[model samples]
Target: MPIDWSPLKEIIDQQNRFVLTSHVRPDADALGSELGMALLLRSLGKTVQIINPGATPAHLQFLDPDGEIKSVHDAPALKQAILECDVHIVLDTSAWGQLGEVGKLMQKSTTQKVVIDHHVSSDDLNAIQFKDTSSPATGCLVYDFTQAIDHTPSARAASCLYAAIATDTGWFRFPSTTSKTMRTIANLIDAGANPAELYTLLYEQAAVPRLHLSGIVLQRVATACHGQLAYTYVTQSDFARSKAHPADTENLVNQCMTIAGIRAAFILVQQPNRKYKVSLRSRVDFDVTPIAEQLGGGGHRQASGAMLPGPKDAALKKLIQLFEEELKKQPPAEKNH
Candidate 1:
């Protein structure tokens, strides 16, 4: 169903101060949507602030070259801004747990809240929601917002939105990529998005430490559940040895899926608190959201995530068990030889 963005338009007309945010450890979709929205609101003469629960990963810093995206933990004044803002818009993610400290303030604030997301898993945020699960990325929705108001995003905003859609769709190779998505990409390019430059900055700019971390994580990849499931892990010790940040683990799970005959894949990266951040990926027909939601996380059908408390072995055992049960439901033909 097409969202009637008029309500949001009215809200924008009524409100002046806006604070935009997204889930923790935000990906391109999250950061890009916030940046695009900030530009749109600013063009309309509204004051906007882009704040997040976590800092932008080192690799993604080029998207916000001006350092407009602020982390709440790093800046104490963001809390005041959140409280004083007339409207708060959450992009990319709809889960409160994903919001971290920002979620706490959102709960306490009686001000109007808005959600502009594309994810299937969501909580009742008591805000007017503009969500289309069928949409490939929240960047598409942000583009729709611009169309609803008939406003063109600035070139930089176009680049951000282009990056958001491009990354989320796996460079237009994911199942979610459609002709509509391509048209949006075209529109963004027409608005001055340079795909080649963006791609290089996003992928080709990998650091040596990231390559070392990838080597460590990929070396540990192992298959189970009749060779239908591939899994890997990265420990704090792995980070120490590689001299790489946790962000370096991004997209490592997808590499496991490259193994032919593997129906599903996951990578558990141990967080600073010793909890494991489980990133799950699977083929289109095999939904992973249920698996993620079972563990208090939620995402798309093909890609989802969860956090699991771990002694490492225990968590691995649990994940294997879950994947085993899930794979069992598949037809015999779907199983690997």
Candidate 2:
């Protein structure tokens, strides 16, 4: 199906002031798309302000060389910018809950709303939403937005977008990586993305405290449904003990799936507000999107996540049961594969 970019293009032409945002606890794709689009907007002489509900993860902060992303608190000026913007662009997420405080503020804003994301839409915000779950990352859609508007990205914009696509698709290892996705990355590299440097910053660089936390996370990995399902968790206490930031746990789910014979993996991370951030990953012949959606989340077939409104222990126990039940529904022949 042809993507309808006219709605977003119209907004770009008609408006000069834009506020860009993403979901809380955003990953590379979210920030990448935000920063890349912000560069495009500024290049066009359109004023841009990036206001995220949460802070950027330290590992990915290099994308913001000038430190443009601001939390609603850190930048008091964001209130006025958001309130008086000609358009508000929400990136990488469509769910109201994922948007956090920004979601609440968006409901009250009468200005034009635009959503650019790559996840399966669970909530319709009645806006001009552009989503293609087929794309590896939201940054791909943002790149397309620029192209549709006839705006060539700057070298910095290309690097930002390349990092976004690279991280979300697991450095092109994930099954979601497409020919178009690779082509986009090639163009980004041609524009200026340094693959070697991005890999070092995104994956190789980690604080000593995070290593301590990883040991704790690995020891706790548990299996269920005859070892077909693997699950792990990181508590707030764990972070406190290791002196690690919450963002340090970002890629722990990938580790949970490294074991042989594992069909799926889930990580329940305890957030500050008593809620748990659930990350799910699928292996061969498995799709965890249903599980994520059941728990009030949505994403791709291979990866998805949700936020639990209960305690971590309770959510962990409950999810164990659900995952076991899901395993029972799978074909016996598929389990050993």
Say which candidate scores most in TM-score.
1
Off by over 4 Å in 1: 216-226, 232-242, 267-280, 287-325, 332-337
Question: Model 1, residue 103: displacement in angstroms?
Answer: 2.6
User: Which runs in model 2 stand beyond 4 Å of their true positions?
Assistant: 215-224, 231-250, 266-280, 287-324, 332-337
Model 1, position 208, has a per-residue lDDT of 96
Query: In angstroms, how far off is 316's CA in candidate 2?
Result: 8.5
RMSD of each: 3.7, 4.0
**Strongest candidate by lDDT:** 1
**Worst-scoring 10-residue span by lDDT in model 2:** 328-337
lDDT of each: 0.92, 0.85
Residue 181 of candidate 1: its Cα lDDT? Answer: 98
lDDT of 1 at 28: 97
Residue-wise C-alpha lDDT for candidate 1, range 85-201, written one tens digit per residue? 999999998889899898899899998999999887649688899999999999999999999899998998999999999999989998789999999999999999999999999
Models 1 onward score TM values of 0.83, 0.81
Tens-place lDDT digits, model 2, residues 184-251: 88888888888998888877877899999999998999888788888899888999999998878877
